[model samples]
Target: MNPVSVTDYRQLAKKRLPHFLFEYIDGGSYAETTLGRNMADLERVALRQRVLTDVSSLDLSVELFGQSLSMPVALAPIGLAGMNARRGEVQAARAAAVAGVPFCLSTVSACSLDEVARSTAKPFWFQLYMIRDRAFMRDLLGSARRLGCSALVLTADMPVPGSRYRDYRSGLAGAPGLRGNLRRVAQSVCRPGWAWDVGINGRPHQLGNVAPILGNNSGMDDFFAWMRDNFDPGVTWKDIDFVRGEWGGPLIVKGILDPEDARSAVAEGVDGIVVSNHGGRQLDGVLSSVKALPPIVDAVGDKATVLVDGGVRSGLDVVRMLALGAQGVLLGRAWAYALGARGEAGVTHMLKIIAAEIAVAMALTGCRNIEAIDRDILAELGQDINSRL
Candidate 1:
């Protein structure tokens, strides 16, 4: 099929990936109420069409964290991406660099910080997970600095891994060697191209950032056990202060959905905050990140850059998020699924499609720059808070 949108890439990913791995990327927590709502709430937002406006030359560029972005979009940190494709993190980073955007590498990624940075000329961002040991966290930050990372994204969610019934049912958490091998073989038979390239020719994946502290988890259950024991639930704002003091660079707090928390991050001096629910993987019944964006944007009062992730699948959804006051949007599963489907080329295509859509949307909405998008668009949609979110 000819892919023209992120959803088309998702269909390709579903066809290429093993069922268990596909479910891991596609499924959410519990009943997935929050997952579905994320996209639905964004769809509820209405855009105003203008008949007379000179948008002949549109500029989607924006200055974020002292970096001039070609467009107001960044790739969110996604875990276990290497399992989706061989050296997937590096592939995705290269794609982001080609598209002129920042790609945040997750702490749990199969590729190392140095590896991803070496793969791209652009300064990629690094996402950190505050483990139970402060010394380890310090070492991780030092490693990122050594790799010349431009930003530190502290993921505050996942103190404990959320319950995913699909993984449990598929036995993905146990019997890693035999079960995983068999599953891959079967999936490769289904998608010969992906199998020959990723499954056969790909190198053995390792978690580059954490390989020193913890070995590559051979079994899913082993990984879950290690994570449950090591993750620090007692992490507090003081931890953020310590990281900021150590890094001395742009520090972005992710997984924030509350207005008070956003305000606190600003007062405590964070450079940015991403309004996300861990892509609906951490919490089940919480409000969608889009629903939480308005209040958080209001609370920050322009003190820090505000970005959001979760259910941002299309260019129109990006428009809705910007209209709701988000400074930018994060592409989570969008790029990951694309990489799984067609390696680097698929991701590059996905980025271009979204960019063109944003430009067209801006032209139709009577807005020239991203900053011109405001709450006024909501009035034209006849949308109320209760009705939309």
Candidate 2:
């Protein structure tokens, strides 16, 4: 079948990937209420289409952090992408390169930063996790700088890993010590392609930037233990200052919900702030990132670039986010599904489809550029979205 959209790629991914892998990418935290609400809130935003305007020469380009982007949309930092396809992170980064957009590599990626950066033609952004060890965190930032990373994204939400039942059942999350090693071997045999292509041929599963701190295939349990011990629970604005001093580059603080946090991020001198709930993977009952964007946009004013990521699947959702005041949008599961479907080719196709969709939406709405989108074009369909935030 010819996959022409992200949804099409998602359908193909479900068929190609194992049940557990599919669920891990597709499912959110327990009950998935926030997951479902994220999409619902985006859909509730109705576009006020304008006619009789010449949008013939539409400009989707956006200049962020002094660099011009082909589009304001970027690929969110997705973890363990190597599990989706053979050398999946490399493939996805290549796709982002071809699409003329940025791809953020996660702290928990299966493929190392060096491998992904080497595969792509352009430099990409690196997302960092604030760990308890200041020295280890410093080393990770230094590695990113050495790799010529364009930006440093500090994810602030995950003090502790959320309980994902899907991963637990898939034998990927909570395992029974060394006994689970036997189970993993059996599962690998079942998925020979994954075993041979990713497990055998590709870089071994390890956080590339943190290798000196956490060594190779230390098993999931030990990794989780490391995470528990390393994650700084009392992360403050001072830590943000510390990172800024060390990196000396564009810094983005992700996982911000409160408008006060957004204001603080701007005050702390962040280049951008991502109004995210960790894609609904961390907190369940919290307001969706989309729903929380307007207030943050209002709070920060023009101090910093505001990007939001959560339940962002379609081009229409991208438009809605812009209309609500996001400088850019990020995708997590959408591209993950594409990577799972046909590796780099699928991801490239997905980007093309989204670009085409965005152009169409812009033409219909009488907007010629991403910067023209505003609150006047959006109408809320559900409970007062303004008050929800």
Candidate 3:
């Protein structure tokens, strides 16, 4: 069957990838309560449709960080994306360029920053994780600057990695023992297509960004260990000053849920703030990004561009976020699912689906342009959801 929605891509990805890798992308931390809430709360938002409105010329274009985007959507950074397909990050970057959207590459991605830069002429964004090594961090910042990255997304939520039960069960965590190795080998043997396309043909399986720091022969186990040892637990707002000193381009601080943090980010001089909960992969019981968005928007929307990411699956969901006062929305698992399912073609297809959906939704809601979307376009289902926020 042909895939039509992001969820359809997810299903296809599950079938094509090894079980452990699929769960790593699909599962959330702990009981995944916040993960489930992200979508559930978005579904609760109802759009106020109107008839007899002139919707002849629909404009979905949005200007962000001095760049014109075809739509108010971007593909979020996902680590180990190369494991999904043959040089998956490069493929996804090319797709994002074709779709005229920013593609943020993770510091832990399978393709190096230079490799992706050489693959596409479009200026992509880079997501940074504040590691313990100051020298390595500086080197990464220099590389991004040299590569002409349009933006630097500093993730602040994961001071420490969340305890994902699925990772443990799938043997992604814990020591790499003989049994776990055998189990992974057996799983790879079963998924011959994945093994051939990504495992065998997609050589240089090491984390491209950190391979120099951990040596050229480093593998998944070494990457995990490096993460455990390097992710600084005592990161403070002062680190923002350090990053600002290094990166002169557009700076975005991701993983913000609280209004206070949003305020602090503005004071720290970030150009944009992503009101996210790490897609519920980080704190499981925290408020969903949708629920947390309004306050943050009210707090810092004027000072900095407010973007959101969490459980945003369809074009209508993007509309909901825009109506709630977000400048744009970042999609994490959606594009990853597409890339895993059908590589570059799947990503391009997914973007077309979402763009078409957004246009249709805007027309149905009496919005002739994206800038006209506001809270007035929303109606309470039964209770005052805005009051709750």
Candidate 4:
């Protein structure tokens, strides 16, 4: 398959990856109600069409955090990206640099910060998860600064990991001990292409970022055990103060979905807030990011940059988010699917498809640029909300 759309890339990824790894990337929390709703609610948004508008000169560029972006989209952080392809984070960072957009590296990434920084000329953003080890967190911040990271994204969602049943059922969580490990190996045997490309050729299969702390020879089960032991569940607002004091650069609080939390984030002096539900991987029944965006935008006003992620599949979905009051959109599974399907080339193709789609959507909607996209482009916000209910 040529794979023109993100969905096509996803199908390709499913076929190329082992069953356990594929389910880990594609599945969500228990019941997956919010996961399904994120995309469904985005489809519910109606776009207004107009003709005879002069859109001959279209600019997809936008300024984010004092940096000019070729488009108002960034790749969201995803763990175990290296498992998808050999040195996947490095490949994804290069793709983002070529596309002229930001790529946020996950704390649990397969590649180290220094490796990615050395590979790309453009400085990329780093995403942090506040674990129980305060000294380690502080040192990680120092490392990010020394590497010249453009921004620090503090993901406030997963104080504890969500209950993803798919992970358990697929033997991804190493639940059934030796039996599960044997099952995973058997599944890998079925997909010899993936086994050779990722399992054999993708050497250094451990989590690179935490290798120094958790040993370089650690495996997926060891990383999971470390996360289970160290993820701090007692974090509070004061922890934000600690992060602010340590990192002097732009700090974005991810996983914010409530207007009250948005107000508190402004009060806490965050540079930006991502209206996300951890891409519906954390919470199960919460409102979709789009439905949760308007009130948060109303609450924060211009005090902070309000970006969004979750169920953003295409450029039109990006337009719908901008119309609903998001300054930018972060793509999670979309880019991951592409990366797993065709490595860096697949990622570059996916970005081009989205950019072209956004241009066409902007031309048809009578909007000349991203700034012209507002709530008015959406057909009756009240009716759309009612329909979702």
Q: Per-residue CA lDDT of candidate 4, range 22-138, in tens?
A: 998999999999999899988888988988999999999999998899999999999988788878999999999999999999999999998899999999999999889899889
> lDDT values of the candidates?
0.84, 0.83, 0.91, 0.90
Which residue pairs come into collision in candidate 3?
A: none
lDDT of 1 at 165: 74
In candidate 3, residue 139 scores what lDDT?
94
Off by over 4 Å in 2: 182-192, 380-389
* Model 3 C-alpha lDDT per residue in residues 281-332, reported as the tens digit of each score: 9899999999999878989958999999999999999999999889999999
lDDT rank, highest first? 3, 4, 1, 2
Q: What TM-score should be assigned to candidate 2?
A: 0.94
**Deviation (Å) of 164 in candidate 4:** 0.3
Better structure of 1 and 4 per lDDT? 4
For every candidate in turn, the CA RMSD to the true structure comes to 2.0, 2.2, 1.4, 1.4
Off by over 4 Å in 3: 381-384, 387-389
TM-score of every candidate = 0.95, 0.94, 0.98, 0.97
After superposition on all CA atoms, how large is the RMSD of candidate 1?
2.0
Instruction: Please write out the lDDT profile of model 2 over residues 1-389, one tens digit for every residue.
Output: 79877888999888777666777898788888888888887777788878999988999999887777898889999877777888788899999999989999998787787888788779899998888888877877888898888988899999787777777777766776776666666766676666676667765666555566676546656666777788888888888878987799999999999988898888888999999998888889899888898889989998899999998888888998999999999888889999998899989889988899899999999899987888767754335557633
lDDT of 1 by residue, 199-256 (tens): 6776555566777766656345556676788898898988887898679889999989
lDDT of 4: 0.90
TM-score of 4: 0.97
lDDT of 2: 0.83
